[model samples]
Structures are given as structure tokens and as C-alpha cells.
Target: METGDLVRELRTARGWSQGRLAAEVNAACGTALTREYVSGWERGKVRPGPFYLRALAGVFDVPQAALDAGRAPGRAGGAAAATTAALAPSVTSDLLGLGFAARLRGGPSADDWEARLDAYGTDYMSSPAADLQRRVAEDLVVVQQQLDAPAMWSAAARLMTVYATTFPRQESARSIQWFRTAAEAADRSGDVGVRVWVRGRGALALGYGGTATGLADLLADQALALTDRPSVGLLHATLGKAYAAALRGDRPAALHLADRARRIFDAAYDPSARLSDYSIPAWRMNGFLSLLSARLGDEKQSAKAREAALCELPERLPRFVTHLELHKGLTLVRAGDREGGLACARAALDALPQERWCGTLQMLMAEIAA
Candidate 1:
């Protein structure tokens, strides 16, 4: 096929109308590329230049030269993009919910992450959005081969604690490998921030299935004291601590840290959104706080926390954040009201953040029934 023919063929194959293609390309670029422009390119009336090439590469996920050569596109769903999908565990669907939420809050550019790497290296432990922590973790898995990239590795270390809470019993050896690689990469760079990040990862791993001794408190301390000063990541660590304490039935300690985390939001940084705008502020602790209060039978506090979390939460959460709603729903169900709890669970099920969690939540429902 000629250029126009190729474009038409690929676009049709993906079932993308000009508008869909334009929207995808627009998302890839930092700016919107209109439908008319998309129309022009597909018709081959005007060849796409380098800018178009980069944007198209992101959209089609193919090498620019290949796309130009009229080769098949490399998208996860499209013909050419199948390689990475096949090689990886197909985590894109899970990560995309995270990415889309992040994209809503912040534009994705390699340069932005590169700059974050540099800034974080100096003081890596502090001040991170939830999305950054998550992306850095997933990126380590995708680019573990690029061990030379210190910035990437540094970011990855910090992200470990975030995902650990989300993935509890589901943690895998691959997850540990990613964490170890990131930690080692940070150590090689001699980035203290990375060290703090690494410690957080270790603490998180321990909490997941290993040691629990002082895990919560020690993690918060390491995250805070590792660098020149306390970092927002310390709060993230605290969040993990709170979760761990809850698992331990240490209601007082968990609630204390969860409350502390909520308080920290008052002084939180205003980073641009990534994956989801909600990840930037790193989610409303009030949600957890409310749920915790419910678990503890603090009716007044539970209502308060719920109101705050619901208010602070953006109307439309990125898919990644939505996954936690299931856990929250479960907490509600186990509290006292089966019908209301099931309703909450149904809402989360309907939202369908990530597919992997589908089975987990389904099982959780069965357990709740039993």
C-alpha cells in the first residue's frame, strides 16, 4: 500500500475514525491535532513530518521509520504492537487506567520524567504524587534492561511502597525483581533519595509477606530521615504503614498514621497530574480514614472521613484509583450493613478499573458471604 493506502488500511484495521485517530494523536502530542489535520494525513495529500512521526509512534506504538516505510503499526491491539504485549504480562490494561488518570493530571513526556529523575535524585524520598510512585514502579519492569538509567531507577524505588499496598497478597517474584533492580540502580547512582526510596521498597516488601517488626514506623522514619528533610513520600510510607497496621488489627496506630497522612495533605505539593489528576495529590486520605473509622465502629468519624474523601475525590478517577474502591467497598460490607456494602461493591465492579482485580474482588465477595 502507498502512504494513503497504508494509513487508511491501518486506521480502518484499528476501527479508528478520523476523529478517534486525531484524539489519540492529540493525546500523544501535548496539543490537540484536529480532525481536519488527521483527515489530511490519512488521505496522503500531505505527508506527516517528524512531529507527526513521534506522535504517531506513540499512538501506533511503532518505530517511526517503520511507520514511514508503510509497515504495519505496532500498537498493543494493532498488528505491529503485539510484540511488547506478548513479551510482557499484559499489564498495560492495568497500567493504562493509571496512565489515563495521570495524563488527566499531567502531560506525559519523556523529558518531564527525565527532569523528575534529576530533581528526585538530589532528594528522592520526598514529595511525590501517587501516580509517580506507581509509574516509576511499572517503568522499572518495562525498562529494567536499561540499568544505566539512574533517573528511571531512582523513580522506580520510590514507587514501590505505593503499589505494595495495592497489590498485597498478589505480590509476585517479578514485582520483587523490579524493586531490587530499582534499589540497586539507586545505590549505584549514590542518590540518597534513591536509598530512601529503596528502604521504603524493602519495608513495603516486608510488610507484604515478610517481617512486620516496626515495619510501619521504621518505614516512615527512614523515608523522612533518609534525606535532608521529610518527604511527601514519607506520607506515602505512612499510608502503607496505616494499611499494614489495619491488617494487624492495630486500630489505634493505623488510625493515627492515617490521620497524620490526611493532615500532611494540608501541606502537600502541587505537582502536575500523571495517569490521573487524583494521583497527584496522591488520593484523599479521608477515604481511607473514613473506611478505617467504619472498621473501628467510630460512626461519627466514619461519616466525616467519608464526606471528606468523597468531596476531595475527583468525580472521575483514573482507572488505577478505581481498583481500590473494591477494597473500600469490602470494608463497608464487613462493617455492618450487607446491602449497602454490596451496593458499594457493585458500584466498584461496574466501574471496572483493572481486570486482574476482578477475580480477587469476586472471591472477596464470596468470602464476605460465607
Candidate 2:
């Protein structure tokens, strides 16, 4: 609904240089309308005069009324992507980043595996704001044809991951309600590992919003025992349990588990093991551990973890990875380097350009700013 932001976005999407757009407007004005005029409008720092409105329509490639349309509420244009991204985790592959490939394969190494699993917690629990009704509907139609439990459970895990995000946003009520349905489907598949994985995500979604918080740990614990070592399910269960602990306000216990998870992740560096085959997802582990370390007041450890995460992020695109920048920024602040921290956080924010899904990192920045 913000006309300025919308204009900026449209311009960027079209790959139009601001100078070029300005030239078009100036040509129509029969006089020089400096680029500053356009810049001011895009920055939301100023409104254009009535004379410029007519020219604005031509440059934006839409009718005059369309440019003025929906300007009242602000941010309505940005909402589509934001809402869509917030509604589902699996669908927000840009946010889920690198974890998606591995989840698809369902494997990870003991080293860094737990951290990778833990890191995805934020994306999994928070909704990307999509209406997944159509996809879920399609899935259900196909799911009926899936006689194999493993196939059904695999689909169930993917759907559950998306539903977990949708549940918080209330974007897909049907999908949220059907979480139990998927869980049952997974449970019936008779593979305890799949069952544990799905249940862990369910518990994670519940724990994320602080509802059914107590039971999440119980389910996560169950997932823990069910999964074997060096498994994706096992790693996910560990992170899920740690998050439940964190949510319960037992940071010490959370740290203990987090530490073990980190060690498991570190073991992937074995000289004999190929980093690719070991299946340990470095980005998720770093993202999860770094944020948690920052929260526990372990600045030195947090800084080290976050620094490494930034290095590893180039390979993936999880929305939560942006928070690694936020964490390092905040840790710098706690370390009394306010300027560096601000730069890091601002840069991170700039990279993503929004905080609709980064609740934890947003709060951390807010605290620093306060």
C-alpha cells in the first residue's frame, strides 16, 4: 500500500535505471524534473505535486489511477510475497535455503547435523504467509493414491513443515487442522523414524507459538529415542528438544543440549569423510547454534559461531540465515562495538529488506537499538 515502496519495487523488478525513468518524466514535463524528485518519492521522504502525478503514471508503465490505487493502507503491494513466504516453510525455499535439498534426501551427518536441524526451527515454526490450500488439496488427492507408508510419510513430513508455518499465520486453517491428519498418516506408515520426524516438527510448531509448549519436549524426547545416530531425524529431534528447553526458559539445559549438538556437527570434518557425503548441513547448524549462543550471553562463542555462519551462508538461502547477521551485530553491541553491530544488523536487514519472519532477530535488534 505504500506507494513509494511499491514504486521502488516495480522499478527494480523492471530493471529500469532511476536516471532513465527520470529522463522520461522530464521529457513529459517539458522541463527538467531532477532525479532528486524521483528519489524523494521513492524514499517516502516527500510527495510529488499534482503536476508530476500524470507523468508518474507513464514511467511506472500503468494507468494514472492504477498508480494511485491502493495507496491508502500502505504495504499492500509487498504483502503478497511477504504473506506467501510467511504461510509455508517448505514453499519458502528461498528462506529454507540449503536445508531443503537434504530434507528432500532425508539425511545428515552426526557432525553439524544437530545444528543444521536446530537452525531450521525458526523457519519451520513461523508461517511464510502463503495460502497453501491448493497445494495441500492436490497433495491430499495424490496422498490417497500413495499406498506406501514411506511415500506417504515423506510427503507428510514436507506438508507438516509447511503447515507448521501456516498455523501461526492462520493463512491456511484447513492445513493447520490437517497437521494431525498428516501426523496420523506418518504414524501409520510404521516407520518410527518418519513418525518421530513428523511429530518433532509438530511439537516444534506448537512450541514456536508457545501453545502446547509443555508437550513439545515430550514429543521431541520421544523423537530422540526413536532415531538412530547420524540420521536427519536424529539431528532434527535434538534441535527440537533444545528449542523446547529454550522456550521453557531453561537456558542452561538448552545450552547443554546445544553444545552436544554442535559437537555432533563438528565431527563431520573427519579427514576420511567427504564433506558432501557426510550429509551434515553446515548452514543450519551454524544458524541455529549462533542465534542460541547469542541468546545465552556467550558472546565469544556466539561471535565465533555467527562469523562462521556468515561464511557458510553463500551456499544456502534460509530466511533465518539473515539473523546470523543480526546475531553477530547484536553480539558486537554486547561486546560494546555499537557501530559495528549496527552496521552488521542494518546490512543483514538490508540484505533481506524486511523482518516479517525474523521475530527473534528483530527483537534482538530492537533491544540493541533501545
Candidate 3:
């Protein structure tokens, strides 16, 4: 096989277009290459330089030697191969065969769709909302046509969760519309777990604005009612209710709810689980507690939660870590260190990428400055 043939095979095996391949290469190598370049290279009209060859090797998870040899890389044997083999199916379909027809099919396979959703969920806290929203919207167009399939219901629901969160909080109507769609999808899926997940996430989205406490409360109640199990869903619902209580100026109730959320988190959290939006990490729970405590003017509790959140914080989630710092600033403001608190808040905002800042962060900053 020629290098071009090998490149085309690998790209098509992953169901990527020339444009997608170009995007992946650019992302990996920080290059400005385009689909036209990808087309030229695959047609043997142009050859990649050493730099691009190395970039392509990394993107394709193959050795530079394999590309140079103009052959497919040898697969490993046994269980690991069994697991990954389906992800890289043989690209033997020629234009006429049923295999070729299926290869040209529009919708993603169940596993592919699920993996995409999982990636979206895992990247939610780290990626810019606009970027994440664009990616989710692209997938939504394809998934929307297949919602009648029970297998696609969970995908639809999860995609709606992304839409619900990515919309600005001030756009409550748009956000709630997605939340409602997610609820409908979850119900149609008939998966109790997904139903709980949607309601819990919806409650949090509604609670963030401080004006939709009633809707947040209702969603949280439904989330809890759907499951007696100790789960991430339960933790989120409890946190949502805690936020609603805090917004309503019921400090004791908020504190109690936060404590309950912590217990559910302790019982349910799986250290081995994939780190996605569907799973509540200790850091996220602590951050919420810190924010809620700060809002209630409980400086000590807020400080403890802030420190706990910081200690377990992951490097990828800068926005969340920044929010935790803002919570500390809020505590400082409540303690009369007005100038220091404002400085702290400003520093936190400065450390985060401006594109990732959202309405919730702005609200926190406003509270600290006020």
C-alpha cells in the first residue's frame, strides 16, 4: 500500500471526512492545513513533510516507521485488541457492495454515538461553552432524526443536557426548553437512571439563575423521587435544592441539604467511573458547597469547602477551580476584607480564559463585588 492509501484507510475507518482529518491534523500539530491539502496529499499530488508526517503518525496512533513502510500497523493480540478492533474496521468497501452502502450511512453506530456523548460530558467543565455547544449541535442534527429508536433516546437526552447548560443563564426560556426536551427524551427512553439524571441536571441549570427557584425545586424533587438509590443524580438534586434554599434565604435548610448531598456523594461516588458530567466528582460537590456556604455568609464552612475543592481539583478544569477561588473571595468580602476580596475575585477572573467565562461566574463576581 502507498502512504496515501494508508492515510485514506485510517481516516475512513474512523468515519472521518477529509475536512475532519484536516481539523484533527491541525489540532494535533498546530498547523493551518485545510481539507484541500488533505485531498492533495491523499491523491498523491502532494507529499507531507517530516513535520506533518510526525503529526499524522501521532493523530493515527501509528509509528512513523509504519507510515514510511506504507503498510498498516500490526494489531496487538487478545482482549485489548478485541476491545479496540471494532473502532478501526477494515476499509474494504468498494462503491457497490452492501458493505460500502452501510459505510456511507448517515447515522453513527450506537457505540460511536455513546462515545461522542461521553466525550462531550467529560469535556463540559473544561471546554469553552461555545465550542462545546457547536460540537453538540452538529451531533444533534444527526441524532434528532433517529429519536424514535430507544437506543438513541439517551443520546438525545444527554445532548439536550449540553444545550441546557451551554445556553446563557439569562436565556432561561431557551435553557428550559432544552431541559424540557431532555425530560421528554428520558421518559421515552424509559431508563430510570437517565430520567433521574435529566431532572437533576435540569434542576441545577434552573437553580443557577436564582430566579427559577420554584422550577428548580420541582425538578429536584422529581429527581429524588425517581430513585431511592444513592447516586450522582441524588447528589446533584440535593445540591440543586441546597442552592434553591440558599437563594430563598433559608440558610439552615441549605446547610442541611448540602450535608445530605455530601453523604450521598460519599456513598455513591465511584473512583473508577469515567469522569463525565453524569458522574459527580468530590471537587464539584465541594465547589458547590463552597459557593452555597459563601452565599449564606458561613465563612468557616465556605473556607473548608473551598480548600477541599482546591485540593482535589483536576488540571483540565480551570473554570471550576477559578470559581472555587471566587468563593473564597466571597467569604473574604463577607468578613469585611472588601479590598482584598475584590482583588482576589479579579485575580481569579484573570486566571481563567475569557471564552470559558459564563453567566454563573459573572453572578459570583457580582456577589463578591457587591
Tally clashing residue pairs in candidate 2.
24
Model 2 C-alpha lDDT per residue in residues 1-370, reported as the tens digit of each score? 6667766766666566777767655533334767777788888898665445545643443434434662422233433344444346665554344334444544333333234334344333333433343344334333344434455555545454544444322222222334445566766668776676676665544443333344456556777777645455455556656766765678888888886676655653343432331234675567667766665567988877777767766443545566677777767776788898898888777777443443334445665565
- Winner of 1 and 3 under lDDT: 3
- Mark the regions of model 1 whose C-alpha exceeds 4 Å error after superposition: 1-152, 155-173, 197-221, 225-228, 271-283, 318-328, 338-343, 353-370
Candidate 2 has what TM-score?
Answer: 0.50
RMSD of model 2, in Å?
17.2
Q: Encode model 3's per-residue lDDT on 1-370: one tens digit a residue.
A: 8888778877887778999998766543335789999898889898877767766765665655566667765433322232233233532122123333433575687799888988887888678887887677656666776666777898888788887788653344445556766887888888888888888888876665453466678778988988879987777788888988987899889889988887898899888877788777777787888888887988998889889888988887788888888888988888889999899999999988889887677767876776
| Candidate 3, superposed: residue stretches over 4 Å from native | 1-106, 169-172, 208-211, 336-339
For model 3, name the residue pairs that clash. none
What is every candidate's alpha-carbon RMSD to the true fold? 17.7, 17.2, 16.3
lDDT of 1 at 200: 55
Model 3 whole-model lDDT (C-alpha atoms): 0.75
| Weakest ten-residue segment in model 2 by summed lDDT | 167-176
The deviation in Å at residue 102 for candidate 3 is 12
Better of 1 and 3 by TM-score: 3
